[model samples]
Target: MNSLTAFARPVLRWGGDPSGGAPYVFADPSDPQTYTGFDYEFAEALADKMGMQAQFVPTDWESIVSSLKRKEFNVIINGFEPTGDRAREMLFSKPYYLFRLQLTVRKSDGTITSLEDCKKYGKSVGTLVNCAASRLLEEGKYRVKGYQDPVGAYEDLELGRVDAVLMDVAGEMFYARSNPKLKPAGKPFQTGAYVVGIRKADASLKADIDKAIDELINDGTIEKIFRKWNLWDDEQVKLRTATPPAIEITTTKLNWSEGLIKLFKAAMITVLLAFGAMFIAVILGIPLAVGQSNGGPLIRALCTTYIEFFRGTPVLVQLLFLYFGLPVIGITLPGWLTAIVGLGLNYAAYESQIYRTAFQAIPERQWQVAYSLGMRPILAFRRIIFPQAFRIALPPMTNDFVALFKDTSTAFAIAVWELATAYRELANATQSYLGIGIVVCCYYLAMSLPLAHYAHRLERKLQRKSTGILSSGAEK
Candidate 1:
């Protein structure tokens, strides 16, 4: 028996994003352990047709294709549209379900009645990053904001952050259609089809899946699954009679120059965010460290509490709360500012600990000597204690700054397109994950290696200066 034979593998593992939510694979509300959705049911049927049991593998929507490439699963059965870019990376089975683009806007908005209106008024439309809808908006030169999922895009629409959200009709059916505050701005447009993605090496499995899909369509099993989730429509009937559209292979070369330009811009954003947050961390952290080190018990306790709270929690959770949770109490900040504040505040806790340790490392005689020289407490701190502590803390602070550059990637959770996001988008577009990833690494190294080198030099220089001063003092 071949490896692709059902007897060889009793379980067919399919990857999808449960968080992509309904009409796609999502956790069943009644039983959170089990998943439900048209896609979920359809996958089960597909597996059964292949004489195997269906096993669902939860994956993030953004990296689902890459996960498939890594052989994380046997196939990807998510709401994957067969686009030219994706066609280059994986072999797709015949199209299973027809889909369309849906534009959702707030109920109170009268200005944007359609996609054209959004373009005419220059309103920002939110969409899943690197998806067909985003590509559509980009092609039209419309203001586009990319979200990781439809839920965030729709939430932003309701919160008035984005004027409208463009996504698949399947997502709209679950996320936007039921919300009273939101309405479809126009009829769904732009026809497409969802296809199962299989690795190129899995041609046998692809052939098996294609045959199963044809059988399922002919036997009406696919329609039955769709009807269970209220997803059945006239558009699906065409799947039986019509041959799945040929996967368009674009002959154009990957635009390395344009991709590099985008990466450079995004790298600059990463730099700006890292530096801005580091500035805030330094400004806030010094006082926090000082208060904790020198203040009375009550002040020390408060600082300790803040430091513990921020340090103990994950930075990604803090960012999500700052961007999504804050708006619940009527506080809303833009994505960029929120990213800065979130990263800065979280890093401040660590920075405080570093400074506190540095302060403790300074000998008590330094303060006494400054006092003996008739220096006030503030002057003594500035001229003696602080200068030495700063030297002691500089290396670690530089390390944190470098780490903060990487942490800036977490900003993508809140929709800020930093270098990592750019790289992912470029990989998605060009299907050159390794090459683009290497280029992105070089960009980060370009930004961080110089800073790291400078910090090392400065630390050595400071050590030499300190040794010279001690030598002079010993001679005196």
Candidate 2:
């Protein structure tokens, strides 16, 4: 049985902190229930018409592309554009909506008029990352400050971080209606039509979804949702009246040697980055952990704060900040360096905690014996405390390898040709998991599953060695 799902964040989300003001975007507080909007209504009707169980995939908006390509959702039934380049990647259903993108700016600053006119606004134009408007910003020579979500872009505009924000016509109006500071800076620019996306390889599913859209429109369900939202404009009505065309696709064969070679290449890149980062992490983490565990007040405090800060915040942010963020401070690391440095720092912070715990778990008598045997505190810790701590942390330290392996995927954001990037590119291009992605996942499992199995083996072996009766040579 086949199922279809709609992908969307809440239509109504908030922006900006109310008190101190640092931009926030959240699902509509007024309407707390899920699937309350016109999008949900359309999804329900489409499912009924197609006779497939309708599923709603609540996403962070960031995951839309990744989730769709991962086959986590079969159909992306939100405001997605059918662009020339994207058409090469994923199949699009007949547009259910014709959206005009609007440039949003502070009502006080009134200079912009059209998409082309946005050039006068200077570099700090803001838009959602991977959005249609982002392309416009680039083509129009506007430097975009890409935000994670729509509200974040608007918040940037409001806070003066950016001169303007660009979004779909509905989002512009919807956000503008609620927030008085923001207003359309120009004429509503027609960007193009928006359609639900289906992975191109899923031809049958794509056909069924297109058929369902026609069915729902014929039965008046689509119009019902549009009218309910006050969005049933006459222009959109005319567009929908036309017959939805079946999308045609052309397929190409894989370059057997070239692809396999690239696969090996990417795998090597991923492995090297993961292992190198983990190696740096272990080297840096141990000393920091020890210093924090036994150092003077200021040094201990610094180490504790470092551990807490890195552990509390997300590693992805740190990576993005390093890759994209550090340039603001006149320090630049090439993307490759950023990947290794960020991954190393994140795991180092985590590894420090692990070592700290291992040290604390050791018996005080072990330290005393070394000290009583004419060893200095430093020598006692080096000869006695460190070895036991290493033995104690051996299992958890090995478990860290799995996470370190997964962290390599984050390099994709910076355009590093790691396995995940290849998987995404191939999945988008072929629209089939059996193509490049199946091979890539095999690579992931090839790399990770063994390390995981080894970590498990190491853990068990260490457990056995620890529990074994102390022999004359056991002290080593």
Candidate 3:
């Protein structure tokens, strides 16, 4: 049976982050469990035109494009702009809504109003990372903070973390429109258009969507949806009246030649992130283990609190907290350093527990023997108990290294493009998520498997030595 015809109700999954709250996508205030937004309605209309039921998939905007390419959804209608870089990776539908960057600020604070005023006052602005707002900030040499989403930037403005928020006019309408505390500072700048993102390889799908969007425009269906959200504007009307060119899907053969070099470089970065994080883990984890095991009551309590705090919370949250949260306290850290510290601190908690268990498992008789030999307490621990504890910890330590290596992929949350991030980019660029996924898996395995094997071998060797046996399986 044909897959399309087999389903009772064919589902077209649309990816978006509803937490963005407002005209774009957010939980329906009337019904908390249900979603409602302009984009949500637009997706449903598109799915209806295609004779499919729209399935809303909640996704983070930072990785929304990546998620679309990963086949997590069939389309992304989350106000994705048709930028040059993204155009090359994915097919974009006709512009459904026109947007411009609206500078928003607290109404009570009138010292800064325009971009020039912002520059003069040395005011820092916040914008969504990798967006046109960010690009504008970069080109203008403005001190800008990049956020994973527009909501976060606006929230920071509310909290005085940033002086202003440079975001889409549509976003401003939803987020800052009715607020008595905030107001638009000046005229919107940097005009752009919002479009639906479709997978490049699925040219037919793109063509169908473009046709449906054009139809929606002609029949005034989209205008009704826009009006429902109170987003109808002159630019939208102009877009509707203008003729749209037919979509031309140029099917390009998947090429890995250039991607291989990029993937290798990214893999190297992953290695750096992983090993760097692990180095921090081990160097700090050992001392933490010692403190918890051998230190006085206060020291032990402090060590326990530290271990439980990190281990209790998620690594991603820790990373984001370090990167974004610290800037609030005037302690901004670079992305690479944030990745290292976040991963290291998180893993140290786990590694400390492993070391503690190993240390405790060692018999006190060994310490007694060292004392009888006239060795000092610290010396006895260093020379006798420590070696055995390290040996006992090696197996779990090896496992942790492997796990930590994989965990480094999360650094992409803070814009650190490691192996997984590289693969997502390559997959989108080449339109080969399946192929790149395999390559990335192999890359991780190549990095992790050998270490695990070696650690196992060393563990076996230690076991044999402890039993007084030779390699030939005979007694020494």
Residues 1-476 of candidate 1 have per-residue lDDT tens digits of 36566456589999998885676989999999899888888898899888888899998877888888888899989888777777776798998988888999999998998999988888999998767787777667688888888889988888888899998888898889999999998898887788899998999999999999999999989888877767778878778876555433222235888778988999999999999999999889988987898889999999999999999999999999999999999999888889999999999999999999988777677787899999999999998888888888998999999999999999988888799988876676667889999999999999999999999999998887682223222211
Off-target runs (Cα >4 Å) in candidate 3 are: 1-15, 28-31, 41-76, 80-95, 99-148, 151-233, 245-258, 453-476
Q: What is the C-alpha lDDT of each candidate?
A: 0.86, 0.68, 0.80
lDDT string for model 3 (322-381, tens) is 978887788766667789889999999899999989877777677877999999999998
**Candidate with better TM-score, 1 vs 3:** 1
Better model by TM-score: candidate 2 vs candidate 3: 3
Alpha carbon lDDT at 264, candidate 3: 86
Determine the C-alpha RMSD for candidate 3 after optimal superposition of all C-alphas: 7.3
Worst 10 residues of 1 by lDDT: 467-476
lDDT of 1 at 29: 90
All candidates: CA RMSD in angstroms? 3.8, 10.1, 7.3
Name the lDDT value of residue 345 in candidate 1: 97
Q: Report how far residue 249 has shifted in candidate 1, in Å.
A: 9.3
